[model samples]
Target chain A: MIDSINPTAKTVGMLIGSIALGFTFHWQLNVLLSLVCLLFLMTSKRAKLSTMVRVLIPIAFISVSYFMTGWLFSSEQALFSLTNETIVAGGRAELINGLNLGTRILAFGMIGISYSLTTDSYDLIVSFIQQAKMPMKVGYAILTAFNLTSLIQTEYEHSKLAIQVRNLPVKGFDTKPLFTMMVRMVRWSERLSLSMEAKGFSEERTMHRQLKIKRRDIAFAAGFPLVILGLGMILAR
Target chain B: MNKKELTLRDYLLMALISVVFGVFYLLAVYAGTALTTVLTPFGLGVLGYEPFYGIWFMAAIITTYLIRKPVVGIVTEMIAALIEVLLGNMFGVIILISAFIQGLGVEVAFAFTGYKKYTYKVTMTSAVTATVLTFIWTGFRNNYLAMDWRIVLAIFVTRLLSSLFFTGYLSKLICDKLDEAGILNSMQTREVHDR
Candidate 1:
């Protein structure tokens, strides 16, 4: 269900909705939204338990750190003094603010993870090209580059190994190899473009794959923000 | 200088460069996250993360330099942000906004140069412009105004220096090395021949 929705809509909707929700500073509302997002993730077929765990671990760490920071460093007045003299300001407002910030971060992460796990990168690019009217040449080039990531990673590893084998002076922060790799990749892109041109790739080309927005996609695209906004309003009150 | 449409080669180069710097950006995010966690207790939470802010703009600056195009910086940064989101960045959808602003900052800087100059001085000026623009945007967005003035100042200064170093000095250095390797000249030659 999540995968079938237009990526551009999902991305734009989630971005706009989340940014709107983030500024609300209502901890309860944010928490409810985050839980709803988590429920969505849990129900999605693409979101595995392991993936959830991997994503949440960082969110948990960040939330904890945010809470700690807000508690300790917030300039708000102290609601109550702690027993420890070093512990200066322990305020209810500050604690709530921390929770709000942390949970908001988690909510944002959850929304992102849902989009990423469900949406294919190619589909996203295609949606950009088709729906958002991005230039086809630029879209295809981005697709090519995206596909080349693993290959580039492999080459980077190989270069590192080669440097090790040759016993080169592996100084701290050595960027020479990086620059060389970049230049090489640029050259490869040049060649690739030449080959593509030879094959008659041009501005006006037909796409074989068709992207249609189904009824379910419309429901999802419209329903998500409305539901979140409703819940936010209710909870804020 | 005659304006030319970007070729497939230019787009691909932008992508390639974005991918390379995207990795650096991912690492910087990790480092910034860790430092923010470690430093938050000392009231230096936001300031601690300032240094990593400029690394985000490196791809945009470097790509603009290499491509010497008007919107390449914005496009490259957007692509990089997409990749980051795809890679499961915790900031998620908001990364797009950050990337857009950062890219626009560099794009505006280049625009000030009439998209003609790619000098070290121009690069530095662009970096500073981008840094200041982003700083202001983030400050307003994240409610940094509520924070103590000292922390805000520290963040601003550190972010400026970091942007200057990574996007300005470091990107220029890499482009110079690429030029020295004759790869840039070859690409230029191919572009001329194709034209």
Candidate 2:
């Protein structure tokens, strides 16, 4: 169901939702938002549980680190006191703040994963051109690059292999292979543009996939943030 | 056709290079996350990602150095961030905003030189500008302002060095190497002649 939404609309909705999430520093709200995002990801057909887990492992570490650092260096530490009772209270407050910082990372990771796992790269570009008003030329250029990614990967491996075979002195910061790669890519770009021109490619061309903005898109765009921020307001108290 | 305008080849090269750097950006994030976890006990987790921030800006720097055109840094950075999003970057759409702002920093530095000079000083200037601008943005987004002053300073210093090393010095080295090897001769010659 999430994948069915236009990628542009989904992106806008999530972008606003993520921005809203950023301003919020409440742990409860962050946890709630993360859980909601996790639920979306879990239900989405495109998000494999294994991939999600693999991605979340590092995010989990970062989140924990944030929590620890947030506790120790919290700005609220300026409220220092000598009294034992006040010390304990301050410590607890710092802990809560730390949790807030930590959970914020989780929330963001979940939100990002929810969007990225479900969205298709090609569809996203198409939506960018069709809905976001991106120039067709830019869109096509990006698509062309997208197709070259695999070739680029192979080229990178070949460069590395060539370095080993040639026994080049370049070790850590070798620019030789990078230069080679860039030279080849430059030639490829020149040829690609020429061939595209020869094939009569133009900005006036039509797209095979037409992404439409439905009522659901509007609802997701507006409602996602409204729900998250509204809950944040209620939970902050 | 304006002589200074970017052609299809320029756009394609920018896109392709951005794609490569986008992958590097992902690797840098992993390294950063690991570093962050290691430093978490010292209450300086934010500093972990500082070292890798330069890698994020490399696409912009390298593209601009090679292209020697106005605003190529900004456009290349934006495209790199777009590719990152497409590649499932964990930071998601907010990175797009960060990219645009950081690109502006690189652009401002080059703008001061009237977009003519691609010297080492100019490249380092852009790196410093990008580091400071992006740090300010990150501080706001990550609540770094609320952290202890020492931690903030550390983050800034580490980030500046990282930016200088990777975006400034390293990119300059690579571009110069390409030029020395005659690899950039055709592209540079065409652009110089066109100008």
Candidate 3:
């Protein structure tokens, strides 16, 4: 059932991207890896500009945060001080620091996107618990955690619409409507849980559908380390 | 073995609350970037994230304050946060680590109450709890909070106000609203309603 998406794409993208991230901080290396992954987006049978936007948007924050934290300090060692109000030191050191920090985060987001792009949601969970050695029981417990990214949006929208229909003053930080939604969601979880058990969930341990570690998995895992070593070498030189 | 086992219904409620808290947090997080830029000068900057995000603390308070238990808040909030991580927050492992610390702050309120009960005092306690614990952690993590005492004090005061106003007050307001709707009639809401 989970094979509905580019099941291999996420697996490969994440595997390669994660290795690239782990192996090197060399600007060229990371940039190459990012561009390669971006090419997958370009050539992707399914990847879109919207996905690019969604993925990179989170990166912007991480990048900006790195700059703010790395450059802005109370020290006289200021980088190119912008009238930016925040204490950002302006210079080569500061610039390098920003790039270093920003690339690291950009890699993180890129890896995340690549993973999401290639992997099915269900398989991702399965691999984490089964292969990664996380407790399966807790994994299943986390399965209940799925509603956050999915149907809850509909529920929140419905609640907001309900308020609009009632002509409630749902604006300007009153938080009454927000509060109303919180209680209702808490109330709904109970009902959803009952449905799970009534539908035959149990403590029985049965063999689960497991994913096989392919040659590719090994390649990515092994390659990631080598890349990191190369970056360290570059930095040292 | 005759444990008064929590029913599936109770378990579901826990998950639901976790989900609810998750939604609340997502709102706060998104609202932070959009709102902080505008409110920076007015000192409403504390309402934003970045310098300090208090969602973990707020989530802990909501779940614990309602469940009226000690570890429930900490455990629930942590799990909810892990869900946020799983949902692919870019903060990565750092957020996962922060969640537990933040939850511990709210858990202190429950601890101070001797793990005995929940009340408006406990609510305020947990609010104070979130305030103290989170303020301390953010000082170093955000670096901004770690500045001089004036800045530290300002950050602390800003966080405390956010906790009371957004976390405690908002949580209580939700509890009251749900009661009026009769959905939470099973909880203390009904008891208050009948009176």
DockQ of each two-chain model: 0.50, 0.59, 0.22
- RMSD to true structure for each model, in Å: 4.1, 3.0, 7.2
Off by over 4 Å in 2: A77-88, A169-173, B1-3, B183-185, B188-195
| lDDT string, candidate 2, A115-159, tens digits | 888888899999999999987778888889878888887887688
lDDT of 2 by residue, B1-195 (tens): 123877777888999988766556666777888888789888778678888888778778777777778888788877777777777777777777788988898878778877778889988998899988998888767767456678788889998999999888988888887777775678877667646
For residues B115-147, write the lDDT of model 3, one tens digit per residue: 665566766777787777766555444433212
Model 1 per-residue lDDT tens digits across residues B47-128: 5568877777877877787777678888888878777766656667777888888898888868887888888988898788
A best-first ranking of the candidates according to their DockQ comes to 2, 1, 3
TM-score of 1: 0.89
Per-residue error at A173 for model 2, in Å? 4.7
Pairs with steric clashes in candidate 2 = none
Better of 1 and 2 by lDDT: 2
lDDT of 1 by residue, A83-197 (tens): 2212434355566555655666567677777777767777788888888888888888888877888888777667667787888864433576677678777878888898988
Clashes of each: 0, 0, 13
TM-scores for all candidates?
0.89, 0.92, 0.67
Off by over 4 Å in 1: A75-90, A162-166, A230-237, B40-48
For model 1 chain B, give the 10-residue run with minimal summed lDDT.
B140-149
Which CAPRI level is candidate 1? medium
